[model samples]
Target: MDEMLSVRQLMKTYGKGCPACLDLTGPDHGRNMCPVCGTIVACADVSLDVYPGEVLGIVGESGSGKSTLVKTLYFDEEPTAGEFYLRSYEDGVPNLYDLSSRKKRWVRNHQMGMVYQNPHLGLRLDHSAGGNIAEKLLMAGNYHVGSIRERAVQLLEKTDIPITRMDDLPRYFSGGMQQRVQISKAMANNPPLLLLDEVTTGLDVSVQANVLDLIREIQRELGVSMIVVSHDFSVIRMLTNRTIVMKNGRIVEQGLTDQIMEDPQHAYTQLLINSLL
Candidate 1:
């Protein structure tokens, strides 16, 4: 099966970097900051492939760079070095990081969707729920107001947001409802790939379950590939087919979610699993 998304040697740094940055920082070194250059490597030499209809989970503790990996994939942050390819975009031929800004925007709107950890980042709280969905459609070049509204309503329904509240601002809804609206907006374009970053964090446990159920339902129904980032292993186990364990700024282990859960090879991965037990 062709990969829905492919990334290689993806790296993100937060300061003027030196050659020593990659060598001196990572799980092996127990840190991600370079003492010689004062650079912080958020992620380095990260690579992965997401197959069509697959849900890939990235799990790590705070500052483990799991979130950074997804953020860079979504173009929320610029990677210092990387090659990104999407099968839907030019048959995954060209490196996306080298694309022009306009082309990148087009890819973002037409090929990929992102649901941020913070609702505020993904939704305009003041805009009506439907309006947020329409904004996404608009970016994807859908201009028919009637069709946009229809699509928005359909997505809201799919995400379990009431059609009656379509005209209501997300701010007026509960935290879970706000996330539902964000999901609706993210899926508005029906992109081939979706990036979700700590989506269930900061929500009530029951609410998180509901949201996770919704996400699983969407994936089952739509067959859209997804990369889900979280520090919660239970969430990873619940939603992902494959899992990647990250530490400092590098991947420590990756395998089938069940296999990794049963037999984690890396010490960091074992430590993570033990914490859940």
Candidate 2:
């Protein structure tokens, strides 16, 4: 499979010029934050690739840079330094960071879909469910009301949300339903790249399973490339064929999910598996 997305030498840091911050540099830095300067290294030297139709998992504890990496890719956060390439964009040759802001926005609207951990971040609570999806479709230049409505209904039904409730605000729906609506909205444009960040967090186990199953179904049916970030091993194991384990702003290990599960080489990876056991 061709690489859908490639990231290299990605770094994100906060605070600058302090001696402590300057001193706190290197791949094996002890902490992500500078205790003396209070500078934070959210991510550093991260590199990875996601192939077309592949589900890539990023697993790590809180503050492990998993979320930061995805956020940068999604354009929700900017990286201090990096090279991002999306194959579908400019034939996957140009560095994304070099694109104009307007061009970047175009890429975000037409090529990538992001489902944030919080429904509020991804959905408009006050808008009707259909309206939320329509927003994305409109941003992508689909202006026909009938076509937008049809697309919204198709996505909602596929995500197990009733078409009857398309006019209802997501704020009125249950948490799981709201999440499903968000999923529907994210896929509103059928973007080539889908980003899921701690998507199943704060939901009940059964609800989480339903959402995960729905995600699996969507991925299988649509063949969209996805980057799923989470702290849970079960989520990663269930959804991704390849996994990257991160800790303290660095990638500790990466491999086929089964191999990582059966024979974790990194101490952090082993400790994570043992905790699960």
Candidate 3:
């Protein structure tokens, strides 16, 4: 099967870097900061492939760079070095990072969708629920007001948001409802790939279950490829077919979720699983 998304040697570093940055920082070195140059490596030499209809999970502790990897993929953060390819974009030939800003915006609006951990980042809380969805649609070049409204209704229904509350501002809704609205807006364009970053964090347990169920349902029904980043292993086990374990700005292990859960090869991965037990 063709990969829906491919990333190679993706690196994101903060501060002025030096030659020893890569050699001095990582799980092996027990840190991701270059003491010599005061550069922080957010992620380095990260690579992955997401096939059509696959849900790939990235799990790690705080500052593990899992979130940074996804943020770079969604274009919310720029990578210092990387090659990104999306099958829906020019048949995955040209590197997306090299594309012009206008073309990158087109790709972001038309070929991919992102649901941020913070609804504030994903939705314009000032806009009404339907209006937020319409904003995404507009960016994707859909202009018919009637059509936009109709699409919004469908998306809201799909995400389990009430059609009656279409005009309500997301800021006024409960946390769960706000996230639902963000999901609706993200899916408004029906993009081929979706990036979710710590999406269920900071929610009530029952509400988190409901939201996870909704996401699983959407993936099952739509067959949209997704990259889900979370520090929670249970979340990864529940929603992902494959998993990538990251540490100190580098991937330590990656494989089938079940296999990795049963037999983690890396010491860091084993430590993580033990914590869950």
Query: What TM-scores do the predictions have?
Result: 0.98, 0.96, 0.99
lDDT of each: 0.93, 0.91, 0.94
Q: What is the per-residue lDDT of model 3 for residues 1-277, given as tens digits with 9 covering 90 to 100?
A: 2898999999999999999999999999999999899899999999999999999999999999999999888888889999999999888999999998899999999998899899999999999999999999999999999999999999999988989999999999998999899889888999999889999999999999999999999999999999999999999999999999999999999999999999999999999998899
Identify the leading candidate in terms of lDDT. 3
Name the regions of candidate 3 deviating beyond 4 angstroms: none
**Structure candidate 2, residue pairs in collision:** none
Q: How do the candidates rank by TM-score, highest first?
A: 3, 1, 2
Task: List candidate 2 stretches off by more than 4 Å.
Answer: 17-29
Model 2 error, position 24 (Å) = 3.6
After superposition, candidate 1 runs with Cα above 4 Å error = none
User: Which whole-number lDDT from 0 to 100 does residue 170 have in model 2?
Assistant: 94
Between candidates 1 and 3, the lDDT winner:
3
Tell me the lDDT of model 3 at 88.
91
Residue-level error in angstroms, candidate 2, position 213: 0.5
Clashing pairs in 1: none
Span of ten consecutive residues with least summed lDDT in model 3: 1-10
